[model samples]
Target: MTTWNLNGMKHHLFFCNGGSCTKKGAEEVVEAMRDEIKLQEADVRIHTTRTRCQGRCEDACVITVYPEGVWYKEVTPEIGRRIVREHLVGGSPVEEHISYTYEDELAARPDTKEGQSKTKRKEAQTK
Candidate 1:
């Protein structure tokens, strides 16, 4: 099978509606993210996917960011906007709102200074 490339983008935000989350405005969050992405013309590819039972029923609504692998439960439209603006757009993980964790190594965006420095350091050492 051929793997689909996400084009080496920074973050991937997944919103899980999965019954419980739908009642908590998960759809609204998705729409908001779509609108925000268009409004800002952001370079980051905000992949929105629906999953079953994010396993945080108490938290209900959930959104997971990859390669950072940070999960945000009980997400709202406001929170969604913040995620896009702060974490997705800013290139930093939002600690206060983080939920679950992912083991996948998230690639850093070359646009950010820290990411740039890391890349430079890696390249220099390789030579």
Candidate 2:
């Protein structure tokens, strides 16, 4: 097995650049985030990643901040900057834009039977 090291990084920001997210301006968000991080001078501490898909297309332009496992959805360029400045630089997550936590993502695994059952139940209730 290959060992991967984080080089003492405190946080990892993953910006989804998949099909849906791309259409929603994921690239612009990435640029804005990078600019904000640079302006805040936190480039050495936080790592940024561009990923293909996070399996949350409905919430396209999704951004996941790891180590804390915070997931923000429908992120625009402005929100991306806030994520860098507020969450990464200030050490406080911007709670208003958060769609779910890492725990919520795990529990909503649509591929699993339990998850599917829950989804169906929720749909039924709505109908």
Candidate 3:
């Protein structure tokens, strides 16, 4: 049973860096997000991840915000920065750039806090 605990962190931001997305400005989005996160240094709590393929190639330059599962597409460097500041940091999902979404995850499962798999977590615990 893959039970995802639902009462953990606040937000999880996953940016897709697959080849298609990269050609579509995913790299710039990544850089912008990094810079913006450094600038805010907030206490609201958020996790940022660089994912492989999110399977939304039409929206190649895509970022998926977890808990919310709010997918923003056609992201430019500028939009990425704004999303960090406004949504990830300020607790508001930027609506203007939203493409696809599945909010059910937000209510049902808590994200794994990024950067690790369940096996990795178990290994760390064992060590």
Judge candidate 2 at residue 4 and give its lDDT. 63
lDDT values of the candidates?
0.68, 0.81, 0.73
TM-score of each: 0.68, 0.75, 0.69
Candidate 1 C-alpha error for residue 51, in Å = 2.0
Question: Which candidate would rank higher by TM-score, 2 or 3?
Answer: 2
Error (Å) of candidate 1 at residue 27 is 0.6
Clash totals in order: 1, 0, 0
lDDT tens digits, residue span 4-114, model 3: 553444777789999889999888888888788767863235666788998878777999888777888889999988998888877776766777556532222123232
Q: Between 1 and 2, whose lDDT is larger?
A: 2
Could you tell me the lDDT of residue 78 within candidate 3?
91
Query: For candidate 3, what is the TM-score?
Result: 0.69
Give per-residue lDDT, candidate 3, residue 12. Answer: 74
lDDT tens digits by residue: candidate 1, 12-125 = 666787888888887898888767866766744655566777776766678888776777766778877887888888866655565445422343334433343345657877
